[model samples]
Target: MKRRNSIWMIILVVLMTISLIGCGTTQSNLENKEAPKPTDKVTIGFSISTLNNPFFVTLKEGAEKAATEAGAELLVVDARDNTAKQISDIEDLIQKKVSVILINPTDSAAVVSAVESANKANIPVITVDRASNGGTVVSHIASDNVKGGSMAADYILKTLGNKGNLVELQGIAGTSAARDRGQGFHNVVDGKDGVKVVASQPADFDRAKGLKVMENILQGNKDIKAVFAHNDEMALGALSAIQAAGKSDIMVVGFDATDDAVKAVKEGKMAATVAQKPDLIGKTSLETALKVANGEKVDSSIPVELELVTK
Candidate 1:
C-alpha cells in the first residue's frame, strides 16, 4: 500500500510539472508575437517662390489641405520671389529635420544647391510647378507648360490668321516655367512665316514690370497685333499699357486663369489665357512627397492637365 501511495504521489508531481511547463510555453508564445508598427507623426516642409501671387496662394492652400488630410504637419516658407531667400529657406527646412521637402523654385538653376544639400542629408526633395536644373529631385509636379504654351500659340495664330506682329511679356528670367512656356510659344510661331515676334522681354512675372515693359514696347512697335504674356499678371499689365496707348485692336493672351484674368476674358478685354490647376499641382506634389518619404516609388515627372480659357 505504501509503495502504491508513493507511486501515486510521483504521478501527481509529474502531472503538475507538465502543466506548469505547458503554461510557460503558452506565455512564451504570447510574448513572442510580432508587435504593431509605430504610428509616429511626420512633418513636411514646403517652400514657395512667392505667396504674393494668387496662383501660389491657391497652391499653398492645397498643400496645407493635403497635409492635414494625411495626418502630417507642414511648415511653409515664402521666398517672396527672391532666389537667395528661397535657398536660405530650404536650408532652414533641412536643418529642421523635415521628413520631406517640397520646393517651388524662384530660379531653377539656383535651387540646385539647396536640393543637393537635402540629398546629402538623405531627405527626398520634390519640386512643384517648377524644376531644378541641376539637382536630384525625386519628383516634379506641374502642368505641361510646353503644351500650354503651344496652345497659347495656336490661339494666337488663329486669332491673327497666321500673320501678325507679336510681343511676348516673359516671366522670371531663370525659371523653368518661363523657359518652357517661351519655347513652346516660339516653336509654333517660329514655324509660321506670317507671325513675327517683334518684341520679347522679361517682365519678371510682375504686373507693374509688365506694364512698364509693354509701355516701352508700344512706343516702338505700334503695329503690334497681339501680346502673349507668361502669366496673367503680366497680361493684365500689358492690357493696361495697351488701353493707355489707345490700342483697342490688340489682343492679349496670358497663362494662369486667375479670377481677374477670367473676368477680363469675359469682359472682352483679353483674348484668351491658359488655365493651370494650381490647387491640383500643390496637392499632388505634397502627396508625392509623402510617398517618397515612405520609400514608395513615384514617377519622376507628373504632368497636370492644362486648359486654354477663351471668350
Candidate 2:
C-alpha cells in the first residue's frame, strides 16, 4: 500500500509539471498571436495636380528617382487638374494604407476636404507647388510665388522703363499661386502712375486657353506693352497669340521656367521666367515625407528657392 501511495505521489508531480509546461507554451502562443504585424515596406502616394504639364512631369520624375534611391515605393496618381478627381485619388490612397501622401493641389480651397480626410486618417500630408487653404498639413514645400511675381514685375517695369500698358494672364482662378502672384505683381504695379494693367483675365493655366484669352484681350487692348502670365504655360500661349497678332514689341514674363519657356527666353521670345525648381520641390517633398513617417519633427512651412530665368 505504501509503494502504491508513493507511486501515485510521483505521478501527481509529473502531471503538475506537464500542466505548467503546457500553460507556459499556451502563453507563448498567445503573445505571438497578439504581436503587431510589421510592414513590408514604406509606400508613398503622390497625388499630382496634372501630369500633362511638363513641370509636373519633371516633379514626378524627381520624386520617383528619390523613392528609388531610398528603397521606398511611390504610387503616383494624376488628378488631371480636376479637384473632384484629386479628392477621390486621396481617398483611394488612404484605402491603400499609404505610409505618406504628397499633394500638389489643383485648387487651394477645393482641396481642403481631401486634406482634412487625410488628417482624419492620421496620415501626414505635404503640399508641393500649390497650397491648400484648409488642412492639417505636416509641411508645405513651394516657392515664394509672391516674391517670384514681384521679381517678374520688377523686370517688366525696368524693361518697359516703368511706363507701359500690361496684360495680366492669370492661372486657375482660385489657386493660391494665382492670388499670391497677382498680389505681388500688384504690390508694385497697382499704384504706379506710369504703367496700367489694362486687362486681367484668367487663362486657367493652359497654353491654348492663354492663347484664346490673349487673343480676345488684344482685340480691345492693342496698346498693351507687356504681359505677365501666372505660369509658363499661359505665358507661352500668350506669346503665341502675340506673335500671331504681329505684336513682337510686347515683352512677356512668365513663371515656372519650363523647358519651352526657358527656350523661348533664350531665343528672346519670352522676356523672363521664374524658376521654381519643381524637381527640387519634388525631391524635397519625398524626403520630408519620409522624415514624417519616421516620427521626426519637421517645419510646418518649407520654402523652396526660386530664381528668375532671363535671356
Candidate 3:
C-alpha cells in the first residue's frame, strides 16, 4: 500500500510541474501579445531663410503637406533673412533633437557652421531652393538656376534681336541662386557683341531695393532697352521703376514665375519669367529628409525642373 501511495504522489507532482510550466508559458505569450509595437513616426526640422517671400512661403506650404502625408512631425523656424538668426535657429533645432534637418540658408557660406553643427549631432542635413557651401549635405533640392538664367538670357537676346543695352538687377550677393543665375546670364550676353550689359547692381533680392537700384541705374544709363532681374520681386520692382521713368520700349525679364510675375507676363508687362516649382522643391526636400532619417540613400543633388514663361 505504501509503494502504491508513492507512485501516485510521484504522478501528482509531475502533473503539478507540467501545469505550472504550461501556465507560465501561456502568461508569457499573453504578455508579449499585449505589448505595444514600436512607433514609426519621426520628427523633422525645417529652417527657412525667410517666410516673408511668397516663394519661400509656397515652399513651406509644400513641406508641411509632405510632412503631413508622411506621418512625420515638422518643426519650422524662420530666419527672417538673418544669417546669425538662422544659425541660432538651427542650433535650437539640434537641441530639440530632430531626426533630420532641412534648411534654406540665408547665406550659403554663412550657414555652413550651422550645418556642421548638425553633422556633429549626427543629424542629416537637406537643403532646399538654396545650397550650403560647406558641411555634409545629404541632398539639395532646387531648380537648375544656371539653366533658368540661360533661358532668361536667351529670351532677352531673341527679343532684343541680339542688340540692346541691358541692366541686370541681381539678387543677394552670396546666395547660390544669385551667383549661378548671374553666371549663366552673363555667359550668353558676354559673348554677344551686340548686347551690352550697361549696369549690373545687387538689389539684395528685394522689391524696394530693386526699384531704388533700377531707378539709380536709369538716371545714369538712359538708353537701356532690356532688363534681367534675378527674381520676380526684383523684376517687378524694376518694372515699376521703368514705368515710372516713362520708358515704354524696355523689355523686362524675371525669374520665379510667382503669381504677380505670371500676371505681368500675361498682361504683356514683362517679356518672360522663369518658372521654378517651389512647391515641388519643398515637398522633395521633406521626402529626402525622411529618407535620410530612415537610413536610406538619397542623391546629393536633386534638380527640380524649370520652365520659361513668356507672353
How high is the CA lDDT of each candidate model?
Answer: 0.93, 0.93, 0.93
| Cα-lDDT of candidate 1 | 0.93
Give Cα distance to truth, residue 304, candidate 3, Å: 0.3
Give the lDDT ranking, best first: 2, 1, 3
Q: Where does candidate 3 stray beyond 4 Å?
A: 1-38
**Steric clashes per prediction:** 0, 0, 0
RMSD for all candidates, in order, please.
6.2, 5.2, 4.6
Find the 10 residues in a row with the least total lDDT in model 3.
Answer: 31-40
Cα lDDT tens digits for candidate 1, 152-212: 9999999789999999989999999999999999989995787799999999889999999
Which segments of candidate 1 are over 4 A away from where they belong? 1-39
What range of 10 consecutive residues in model 1 has the weakest lDDT sum?
Answer: 33-42
TM-score per candidate, chains pooled:
0.87, 0.88, 0.88
Candidate 2 residue 84 C-alpha distance from true site, Å: 0.9
TM-score of 3: 0.88
